[model samples]
Target: MTEEAEEELAEAIQLAQGLEVRGVNLANEGKLNGAMEEFRTALKGLEKFKRRTKLIRARIHYFIGNLHTLQGDLPKGLQEWQKAVRLDASLTDARMNVIKSLSDQGKHAEALRHAQLANSQPSPRVEILVMEGDECKALRNFTCAKLAYARALQANPRSFTAHFQLAVAHRDLMEDVPALHHFERAAEIDPTSSSVVNALAVVRGDTCQWGDPDFSENSPTNLLSVFATRDIHDKASPIHPLLLAYHLDNATLLRVVVDSQAREAARDAAVSVGHAAIQQHTNRPDPHARPRKMFSYKNTFSAFW
Candidate 1:
């Protein structure tokens, strides 16, 4: 493209971005129809620019997809996201959304195909690789999942999700030593993450490495102490339930198991209560009431990039 053409494309993209911001604000204000109109208007304006506006067009489609899902039209939402990636192969967020939606709908093979398409992009995102690993895991292709996660780690060494999931992939393949190493790294990276702490503790206990002086230099010698010191009533779910049955005595294990069950039951009860409240509010709309976070879709969609 000529310099003038490049400048025109940039100007067009800037206009579309402004429209996207307006659309997002309207959506946040619970004006779904207005948001949809703003997005469609942006799409119509971009149509004339053709290939130059491909990325922005894809983004607009992705936003439209989110709006569709917000309006409880999931199938239509999926179609919009699919249209997005077809417009621009490098639209990472749109492709990731497609991969996740397909995987959630139990279309693992299709998700894998989209993930592989990311390889064609100049620099596929680390999150895409992680999701690729996830799809592989769903398909019972642990080796493939491991490879994807390893690539993700190579791209971002400190990604807690990659390390944790890589550990899990290793565990699935019965590679205890590598799993232990990754789990330790994951725990170190995010000590407050209860799931990682639990996984690390369980692996150490199972491998008879608790308090072993030869633990990794990055890991604490008394790693199990961290798990032991955590609050007994932590709300986060355990990543591995097998931790309950691992190294504790029968009585202590029984008490811990009962507490965990109680916590889960309480959580479920709270969710039910919240759902009931939401339903009641929906049934009686208050025109004067300000919008609150009834759901997190707005935040989630913004964070896609």
Candidate 2:
């Protein structure tokens, strides 16, 4: 309004921006303490300008809270975030940060409450639902986790993460059949994700459905079974190479079985047997290749002569 007030406002805004830049630079350099100091300095400048701009004041508090959060000072971060929210309830970043900080502190109930509040303001993002599901899972509340994951899947049916997490929730609850199905679905959606493939393989093994006729007929059941068995024996067994070999063998066997359609189903079964033999020879050490045992006698025939 007044020229002098305008000049003071401009100076305060410039100082806040400068402090923010310095804080970001310090944070990038891993100087969390220095960054926090700069953020505090920015907050002080913005507070001085708050009489003219409440929005800028809220932003400064939010950024300060973010800096504290990055430094693992949850209480201080939450306090500042709460202040930011008090100033402007529409500060979604502040609300989300507070929820994350609460969740990190193992306050899942409170975190869920805040998450619900945030969602009430607007439709929550898929990532928020995922976070909520993870927290519920960590708290051993599988039902709530499933619900959250289900909501995420409903929001986007093609979300591989949602399917994978839902599978994990089901597995935790010992719902192996559903877990196996969802795990396989996730692997199908994200074939390049080794974690997904490995998880699906684990669920399949746990369910002992590798021998299931439906999947065993055409799936990589045999190869996955061998891998699972080897892993059970030696936890350090390399799986990726074995899995690759298994896939190749499976492809070759599939072609053989298909081409042998004119023959009986027994012929298809024989193809599987041959594929197993090839896999064993290729992936396992040869038993006959070991040194032969030498036989010894206590008395010789020459002694009798």
Candidate 3:
């Protein structure tokens, strides 16, 4: 090929690599469909040049394999990974994918061997360590899983997933205290994670830290708090809010206010504070709006009529 054609091929391959990186990111974030679109786009770009497409093509295949794995097509995913390795044998990422797929297929020995080989690579990544832990967990090796998760944690303490997986490992091993501790930390980092919340609740139940058997009905005291911060489940419920409010209060929550005389005061204080927070959230002045309202519509109609 001419020098100009080679340069164009290099540029196209570079564009494909960027697209594949974006696809990998999207896949990591659990956007499989969108990630697949990006992968296909990258593949198309890589297919444009007849020369020097092996590296970029291998990378694209690796990403597509991840998409398949996420979509639960393990056989297809492993096939894609094999294709990736065949195209470019030096791609450690493809090797990692192969190890993960082998582990998922219950081929523990082969997976472990691949992991050992990958560890000998010049540089190691936390993802490889996490996959090692995943392999252990799949083999019902909680101890090994915990160790791997701890290593990942040491690498990056801010990883909510490592904390969560470590908590699960502890839970599986019947290590309640450590399990609860890790679960709580995970919850604090990702408060919106239902899995963490549910796991924390279950652990608390086992440890006698939680007592409520059901939350289908909101308690009298919690009614105020629940209204102040109810979730989608509460919205879907058929129960009448007022009727739901008649349930006995949480004794644990009520204990926050020491004196009986101050109990009601505390409840009122909490309600007022919560209400103000909600009001402030709702009443944030619109950035794109008139500076001020000249007249209030409701009061103006009432006064004029």
Backbone clashes, candidate 1: 0
Q: Tens digit of lDDT per residue, candidate 2, span 1-305?
A: 78998898899888878887887788778787898788788777776656676676677678777666676676887898888877876677777777677776788888777766655555666666766787787678999999988988888888888888898888878898998788777756755454554565455445555433334533544434433433232332222222222344454433432333224334433343344445553532122222111111121111100
Candidate structures ordered by lDDT, highest first = 1, 2, 3
**Per-candidate RMSD vs. true structure?**
13.7, 17.8, 17.8
Candidate 1 local Cα displacement, residue 185, angstroms? 0.7
TM-score of each: 0.71, 0.59, 0.49
Candidate 1 per-residue lDDT over residues 28-61, each given as its tens digit: 8889999999999888877768767777788889
> Model 2 compared with the native: what TM-score?
0.59
lDDT of 3: 0.60
For each candidate, what is the lDDT?
Answer: 0.69, 0.62, 0.60
For residue 150, model 3's alpha carbon misses the true position, in angstroms, by 0.9
Clashing residue pairs in all predictions, respectively, total 0, 0, 0
Better of 1 and 3 by TM-score: 1
Residue pairs clashing in model 2 are none
